[model samples]
Target: MLEIRQIPVLEDNYVYLVHEPVEKLTAVVDPAVTDEVMSAAASAGWTITHILNTHHHFDHVGGNEEIRDKTGCTIVGPRADRDRIPGIEIELGDGDLFQFGAATARVFDVPGHTKGHIAYWFEADKALFCGDTLFALGCGRMFEGTPGQFWPSLKKLRDLPDETRVFCAHEYTQANARFALSIDPDNVELTMRSKEIDALRAHGIPTVPSVLAAEKATNPFLRADQPEIAAQLGMEGRDPIDIFAEIRHRKDNF
Candidate 1:
């Protein structure tokens, strides 16, 4: 079985640890800070063997070299982005399959959050390391890719099983849902979920690792075609892509 836990660091970043109990091996996704990651891994009694990166953002790969130096783990990421990242031992691309004991993760190139951002899908575990591609109630800011490129990138993730547990790189749900309600005011699902998230944040709980199906229902960015959303944003009858762009634009200021 794959045991997953979130290592919170640097304000809102999340570094996830994926472990295989039988082999006592562990892999981390997006180690934003080195000491926090090392401390958590030590506490868990697992040896870090792989460092998986979704993108080259400083906050995501900042710990790459230090962690690799300490653990001698393979640094895995996009083949095209080797220069941008440090200590890359396994450069991968779309459709690459990686194995860690009984667990396997399939790579999907999900650019737009960054041109080379990728998601790791472990089919058996129904888990996805989505980086900043898909969030609990929103998507990532487009840094290196256009809205056109970003749309298709998100569509790839939308095709995954609804039950898949989405592990995003940040804790942005509370704010994302607040913006979501500005567009989807009457979405009872969003209202209820936002309340739950508000409570979670109040208690210092992380509102992440949300189910894909729940996001599909409550996330405004994912509901680009909702009549209410379009109408509220004055995008009625406009191209769906335009509506998507407008929603992102509004959220940028929100």
Candidate 2:
């Protein structure tokens, strides 16, 4: 079995520690800051044996070298963009499996947030470590990929089991919820979720690790194909990618 813990740092970023107790193995996912990761591990009497990078973005891999240097942990990242990630010892591609102890996470090529972005899904544990590709109520901006490139990537994630717990890398839920409400005003589920997010953020609590089911219902990026969302965007019977592009453009300015 695997145990997952959230380590919030850098004002809004979240770094996760996926641990396998049977072998005392831990993988720190997207370590934005090394000190925060190390301090959390030390507090729990855990040693980071692996450093998992979801992308080559500075926030995601900023602490890669530091943590690896401090704990001698092996760095694993996307094979397609190995040249960008820091200290990549194992370069994985879509459909590749990364194993530690008895736990294995399947890698999915989820580009859009970044051209080489990837996500780790541990089906056995139902934990998804998606860096910046998929967020709570919104998706990442098309920084490196086009709208079409980003749309299919989101579908790959949306198709995951609804029960899967999505561990995203940022605390943008409140803002995302607000944006979702603007676009999906009649979505009761989203309305309620936005209230909950407001309360959580008001109290300085983390609003991450959102269930896939909840995201499917409330996240606008994932709902781009829905008739309701398309109608609101004045796009009926249009290609999903075009609707998705319009949503992204609105969000970019939102």
**lDDT, residue 64, model 2:** 96
lDDT assessment of candidate 1: 0.89
lDDT of 2 by residue, 22-100 (tens): 9999999999888889999998889999999999999999999999999999999999889999999999989999988
lDDT of 1 by residue, 1-254 (tens): 79998999998999999998877789989998899999999999878999999989999999999999999998998876778877888988889998878888899998887888889999999999999999999999988887787877777888889999999999999999899888888889889999999999999999989999998888877777677778988878887677888888888888
TM-score of 2: 0.98
Native-referenced Cα lDDT, model 2: 0.92
Best by lDDT: 2
> Largest TM-score belongs to which candidate?
2
Give the 10-residue window scoring lowest on summed lDDT in candidate 2.
Answer: 3-12
**Which residue runs of candidate 2 sit more than 4 Å off their true CA positions?**
none
